[model samples]
Target: MDLDLAAVRAFVAVADDRYFGDAAAGLGISQQAVSKRVAKLEADLGTALLRRTPNGAEPTEDGASFLVQARALIALADQAVDLVRSRHRALRVGVLGTRIASAETVRAFHETVPDVGVEMLRSEGLADALTALARGTIDAFFGRALGDLGGIEARPVYLEPVHVLVGRGHPFAALDGVPIADLAGRSLWVPGAVRPETEWADFYRVLAAEFGVRVDTTGPNFGVDDLVERTAASPELITGVGEKIRVPWHRGVVQIPVVEPSPCYPWSLLWHPRNRHPVLPELVAFTREGFRPYRPGRDWIPEPDRPAFTA
Candidate 1:
């Protein structure tokens, strides 16, 4: 038979206080209302749950047996509510990779609010991260928001300066900084830029087209270790990396700044409008407070990402 939780709660309260007037005061309800709820509960069970005594109301033998299960039911129900409410759950954030600048930003945010737990999930790229955000698998994402954003809301967070990685014998290795024009006619080997539709690939494509830098996507795309080893072995081959990216250390490889209007990779924090995570606003506030504005004359941003940086 179906049972009303309200009536059950009223019965438990009445049993605890052992008096209808006392139970009504505890429940913030009238004595008559409490009595009616207990009466209804006893009738539904087809047994006397409580019996009036000279001192007060005492639970019957049947009421004593059912009290344990009723309390358990209330405890389980409260736990379920807390779970759905995300009372103490960690905030899940999607980042492109741990070695990139976005991951560092998330780390800094966590450090700022140490009490707020954070879970960092690595994503393939902006497209992958955005899909996770839309699916509600991730609370927020950190990446460049280009093309159609649809219902996604974004805020510019950081602009990481671009750097060139070259072998010791390479011509640019000895220089303090390589100008953007100097990269022309030079091939930038990016193993992960094979997908033309991905956000990172698209950014490099535009960088190649605008600056006359050729992006060579060679076969057998390996991880960063292979990329670092191969780049260090070849004197002529060069690759572009973000200044903040933590690449594997190689004695033969040197990282030099790409200056004279530095090319910057734009980073934005993206989240769905429907996401109601309490810590989300705190993260947004942290990013806003620490944001370093893009220098229009000194920094070079891609055309697609220009609006966000400019705005």
Candidate 2:
């Protein structure tokens, strides 16, 4: 049934002031208007909310009970309005891989959304982040779009060419860019812990297949430093990393570009279309303004062609 908030407000005002004229004055309306609104409320509720007293008016038994609920409703409404207007416009976003961000992007986000308090949630991989997004655990996600995102809305933020991390003393370290074919005889180490699902692992596996390379996976407890330390210790093992990521300069670890049909990692912002966060669109807009068309080099394609599924 349709409940009129205006009538409820009028009834609450009458109940508070105990007089139609006083209630009308408080509401800045005529006494006749206040009486009509209260009557309408009573008619709709099928109960008498107020009764005429000798001096002015008084609430009936039912009106006294509903008076509390009416004030509570108005209080809740006020709270909601205050929440939207105050600094509580917070957004929870999932960030994948290393949590490193460019200085410019950070500055832009703060400038564009000065009032929005952003809470960055970390996940191990894109699939995990996207899962959090789908489950309503996060308002948005920042990372590579693994494959077909069935229900999520994705927007590309930047395109980063994949880089190979190798030991400084390795044979490929002297080269400017390692060709994809050069990985044929090399072993690529990937972290196996908490990756959300097999799709991400499958993408790398497909890359290994298309280029005739050996894909090796490690433990269920691997981390960023662990992967780097392991790669630095083994000259025969190398790993893939995003060029934009700022890995701490290890004594023996070096990062090199991967070229010859260079596999580009496309970073995107993913959000559910029905998200309720008021600041989510503002954040997405801020991110888009920062990266607009971020393809740093030549031979830029929208996505990686090797994975086949991501294309």
Candidate 3:
């Protein structure tokens, strides 16, 4: 039978308080209203649930049996409500990969706001992450914002310095920092950048076109470990990695800073304008407050990303 939850709630309150007046006080309703609700519930169930005594009311034998089920029903209803409202769900955040600089930033943000629940979703790249954000599959995303974002809101969050990775035998491996100009005509192999429309591929394309550096996209793209192993064995071939990316260690490989107007990867936090996750604002505020502004002359940012980072 379809039960009126309000009436069931009123009955539970009266059974617990043993007095309609006390139950009304707890429920912030009048005693007469509580009695009317309980009376209606009794008529619906075709059984008297409460009996008024000299001191107070007590549940009948049938009421005692139904009380347990009534409480369970209320609990299930409340859980369903909370689930739909997203009150108990963890905040879902999309990132390109767990080893990159953005992942480190997410880790730090989580530590700062330890009370807030956060779930990190590993996406392929910015394009994939933005699609997830638009579809409401993810609450927020961390990546370089490029081109038209449609209705999504984006904020420049961090500028991670770029580093050149070279085998120990390479000449630049011994240097403290390699000037950006020195990279001209040098082959920089990036295996996974073969994907055409991805964010990092576009970034590298722009960088290569502007800087005259040759970006080699040759491979059967394995993973980072394979990249690191290949880089350690090849002295002539080099690669670029973000300073904060946690690459697997190779004793023969050395990471040298890229200087003389260092090229920095611009990271931005992206979310739908309509997103109302409780942790979104906190994360945005934390990003704004903690951001280290870009140095115009000392840092080189791509043209499309400049507006967000420079401003």
Candidate 4:
């Protein structure tokens, strides 16, 4: 008997939710439509899948067992379609402001895979980058997981710990790594909470709570120039970075580690679920492999006896 995959997906949803109304809502269809589809599935399977109750429906033993197969089939089918679609000629990738800071990653991508059409879309805000990924404007971007990014997929490429960016004259600049408790009333140049998306807006909130750091709100833009300028100009202000910013000429500025901070940049290579470019997998695999257990914050020192990140 020929059975439609749509009917199967609907049936799985019904089984999971245990209510026809919820299944219909999830599928964006009418309740009657859902019942009809499920009924048709039951007819094909030749069994009574659901036993109706006053509160909600419960799947029979057969229905529950069949749900496993149905959900698996739907998921595998979707993945197969996605894999097949990824075989396209050009790979569209979105570069967040932070990844662009690296410069080498961008240049390497082009040099590494010249055939795939590379389009560089600049995003100042993480929310903006994630939005583009969901909206299908761009394939993937470098971002940290925040809020509820439903359709987008994220694969962590590398991690950079939070560091203290201070000016040369600052007292803390001379220290090995400033303790987390020391930042209680310290003026920090922090990324603002009201971001492009409401979901990721709470990341900083959680960070502040965990680190016990009080931050004064700053700009939404992630401009390298702005960061460099802020770190240089503001003696009292410290901008966070994963690694030490050792600018030899900057006599007035310093980038020190924050002893240990919970807020870290897990540089993830994110992409849309539908993007089917072959280069994407290669790029993602390469970066994930290259940066696995990659810690940029841990700097190596020349002296055998001394540890790294000490003045």
> What residue pairs clash in candidate 1, if any at all?
none
Which residue pairs of candidate 2 clash?
Answer: none
Give each model a TM-score.
Answer: 0.73, 0.61, 0.73, 0.56
Q: Model 1 has how many clashing residue pairs? A: 0
Q: 184 in model 3: Cα distance from truth in Å?
A: 0.4
Cα-lDDT of candidate 3: 0.87
Give all candidates' CA lDDT scores: 0.87, 0.72, 0.87, 0.65
lDDT of 1 by residue, 23-60 (tens): 99998999999989888988999999998999898888
lDDT string for model 2 (168-208, tens) is: 77898899998887888677766652243654565666667
The lDDT of model 1 is 0.87
Cand. 4 Cα-lDDT: 0.65
User: Candidate 2, which ten residues in sequence have the lowest lDDT sum?
Assistant: 302-311
Candidate 3 positional error at 149, Å? 0.8
Preferred candidate (lDDT higher): 1 or 4: 1
Q: Tens digit of lDDT per residue, candidate 4, span 1-311?
A: 87778889888888889899999999999999999988988999999888899878888999889888888899899878866765664566665543433334655677777766766666655677777777666766765655456777766565455676787767788888887778876666656444535323444455566556665566665555566676777657776655622334456666676654334445567787677666777777767655634333452211211221122
Candidate 3 lDDT over 1-311, as tens digits, reads 88999999999999999999999999999999999999999999999999999979999999999999999999899866754776557888898888998788889989988887899998888778778888778888999888888888999998998898899999998899999899998877877689988888888888898788888998788778988898899888788888998989999899988888898988999999877677788888878886877788899888878877875
Candidates 2 and 3, the one with greater TM-score = 3
CA deviation > 4 Å runs, candidate 1? 1-83
The collision pairs in model 3 are none
Candidate 2 lDDT at 142 equals 70
